[model samples]
Target: MTTTTHALAAPPDLGALYRRAVLSGLSGFLRRGGDLPNTTLELPAVTTDVEHLGAYARVCGFRLRDELPATYPHVLAFPLSVQLMADPSFPFPLPGLVHVRNQITQFRPLMVDEVFALRVRMADLRPHERGQQFDVVAEAVVAHQVVWRDVSTYLRRTGGRGGPRGDVRREAPEPSGLWRVPADVGLRYAAVSGDRNPIHLNRFAARAFGFPRAIAHGMWTKARCLTAFEGRLPDALLVDVHFRAPVPLPSRVAFSAHADASGWLFALHDPRRGKPHLTGSINLI
Candidate 1:
């Protein structure tokens, strides 16, 4: 066959490859947990073994017992995630995606002794827009629950992918619940997020930042929002949250969320302290 014929025989449109990534039938093409093809991701479990933690930290480039840091799960699941994108069936380009916001809840505090299985799958996808930027959102589930979640938007600079562009035009809600943070919680979150920002781990440093105590990880506050409504609302909640303040860690607080049929409102509160820590909202289905 001539070169022209061979070239013709090959396909031109690459978007078709994404459709081949078995659509598991969710809200949108990909929206809710279990909406993508069956994929299992097993993250190495953390253990009390001293050698293991040290070695794992060295290999992962994190300090030992320094708090898992909120971003740990993303690193934990990254190796397998490569396969999903390289498979050519998924729509996202590996390096082009940008994380708009990432949040994770420290359920029982990700300790050094617990072994966790990070079950990753695609959830919630639609053309995202920020003035001129466009991208998508996918949620990651750990075990059977959605623990670490991130809304990543990808910019197809070369051309358009023509993903769903159905974005609701509405007013953004403010977070009403705010609480004063305690000291101990800061220590624990630092352990999970692997971030030892002295402001979050040391009182003296916190004083420098003008905080009475070390503050919480921004992701931790985001995680608290996620944990507050985990499995309580629709299986999939597509929210666009912007973090503005660092919640003081370990603040004993009560939270109130008054979500109407049209929108969701979240607030952080420390009834005793009588102030707001951080505020954010999610557009629930």
Candidate 2:
């Protein structure tokens, strides 16, 4: 198989990306990876901004300190990943594809002024119990050294046969703390994260996309969970998350976490529905 590469002048604009995604729709998603060739997108090395990182920290409930947050690099590389997925040849619709899971590794604490190249590639398409799924690999490099990496698994629901049934674990205990998620959290997050998906921004926009109302960003939920574990996380760590359900805007939910031999196990669930919003673990490396 041949690999094709595109050099991006700068990060992609979500508006343009949305236009392309709508044009491709489900047809592109269903046929992705069957015979399509692999492709990668690369962006020139760029310096990080302290102010920008600080803004992200504020929204995600993290205090802005000297070092960048562990999850911040994901935000930096996400646009490039979107740019790859939005390609006409790529196999997935932008709005409907669910981010089922994410795995991120940080080798060390990244300072704000560090410069790094961003690369994103899509591959590993296969069957799932619910539908077909694929993995998008994103990396951040500092002076040719890999400093952080993320593998984002996305699902396109087509209800195909084969593969193991979704794993079911015992329900976690009731959360000890309750959180009142506001309606504008999506907008606030989008402002810093550069992920302005309309489904997460407003009820009207979410309805257009077949959701009852706007939903919170999955990364925000993950970041908030990590924030709660601040002063406890090791310098090198791995954060793995599986998004179980969507948390509608302006909703009240439960948050809980506990430390184990592996690291920290955490969860967010909606009290009203008695369903999990997301479940995740943090492991020291």
Candidate 3:
């Protein structure tokens, strides 16, 4: 019999599962805490079989119904999301787990068979009271270089899973660039990550859960930003980003970035509204 998992449900105590899995993965370059220690995940080069590349084309909004989006790599370690949920320590019923804020500073588009390791080190895990969610930050590294850093905040409610009724984020302020995120755009991005989070699709489904219309996956938006930095620096590494407001569907957005010798600065602007969605810096190795 074939086993199937609901993409949306949180994974069960996955620390052990991840521990077992990572050992067989890219353990060569990883040590408990070698200079830049982080959770490392290595994905083999994706084959060029017609079926696989077809899916990638589809994600990027291609009609071939075969191609997937270039953003697929953002979730290269997406399975880890489930792994984190599987950990018993993985905070359940917490808001931060719900991902209140998401930002991505992409250096370039990833081609097939990149064969890279995703190293994640805890950045911040503490209490925060922004809206109603718990939050955490992890500095994610790839290719022995800091590709990007992330902050994930979530929301939790009591009597749902019957755990704790609270939300928090433990981080200070950094402006985020604003982009005109459209619902149709969101639907397209969610397809790649397999997040299928109703909030990112199906307006009716979103409102049922407490969203106005479908919102873009935080990572999808991040992926679009990643495209902005491709080939601009010498071996792109070192990224900082933040999530500001939810970009709604059918809207116009302005994205702008500036890079100096020390690092690159980026921003998402809602030209009509004069508000920045996110702002951050990127340092080159």
Candidate 4:
């Protein structure tokens, strides 16, 4: 086993990356099971673009400010994380792997003018109720300090390997606010975020795989929830979200939030199905 590395002069081409991922998926499935090695890949440090950040902030309904959005680093690190997960050595097929949850922690507000190095690794392959799961860890380092971290958990529905059972948190409440999502929301977000995953782009593209319709990006959903927290959020905080169901394009959904002893508990759900699209908590660290 060897550590693979790439120094990107510019951001990755998501289309090409996905094609490669598809091929890797075919290879991994043929090999059955494998181990997730603890090798780290360091991507080139990138200087944030003010214009890009402003566009992302607007699309995600966040306030445009001097500081980068708390969820911005997760977007920056996504390409490398995808590469890590889709690498030929990865244990599971990329096509069926579900992004079940994401946890992000920001040590402090990061400025748009700063340059940060992104490091990505994978670990903790475990079992879930319906399948197997693992985590992709991404970190942002500015100067010599770690400024941000994101743990993205993905599930592959392959029965169970008897790994330890993960945490079991209480269910969030029914949503209090309703939102009508437009079909173009996914394309609009992809334009700014550089995530062109076909599953989120169009109905035809989505059905090419397995989804009945295009689904919203999990990160977009998380960002929108954070946007709602705006003024109430601390500069340093931790946000953990579990994605329960896909929010199909041109659909309506609901949102709810309440205060708990640890922090704020929030959820987005589909009223018709009585199922959560996402549930999360905000912990002030």
Which predicted model would earn the best TM-score?
2
TM-score of 3: 0.57
Model 1, 1-285: lDDT tens digits are 111101122212224323432232121333221223344334433234455445444432345553443434543444344444434445434333333344333333345545555544444444434222332222333456554454433332334543213233433244345444555766765554343446778778778747676676555565556555544544334444443334565566556676777556665554665454445566544
Can you tell me which runs of candidate 1 are displaced by over 4 Å? 1-182, 270-275
Candidate 3, position 23, lDDT: 49
- Taking the tens digit of each residue's C-alpha lDDT, what string does model 4 give over 43-144? 667788778788888778899877888888888888777777666777776776778889999999888878788888888887678777789998888888
Count clashing pairs, candidate 2: 0
Q: Which ten residues in a row have the lowest lDDT in candidate 4?
A: 159-168
The Cα local distance difference test for each model comes to 0.45, 0.81, 0.46, 0.81
Better of 2 and 3 by lDDT: 2
Q: For residues 176-208, could you state the per-residue lDDT of candidate 2 as single tens digits?
A: 789888888899999988888889988898898
Provide the RMSD of all predictions against the true structure, rounded to 1 decimal. Answer: 14.7, 2.8, 11.2, 3.1
TM-score, one value per model? 0.41, 0.90, 0.57, 0.89
> How displaced is residue 132 in candidate 4, in Å?
2.0
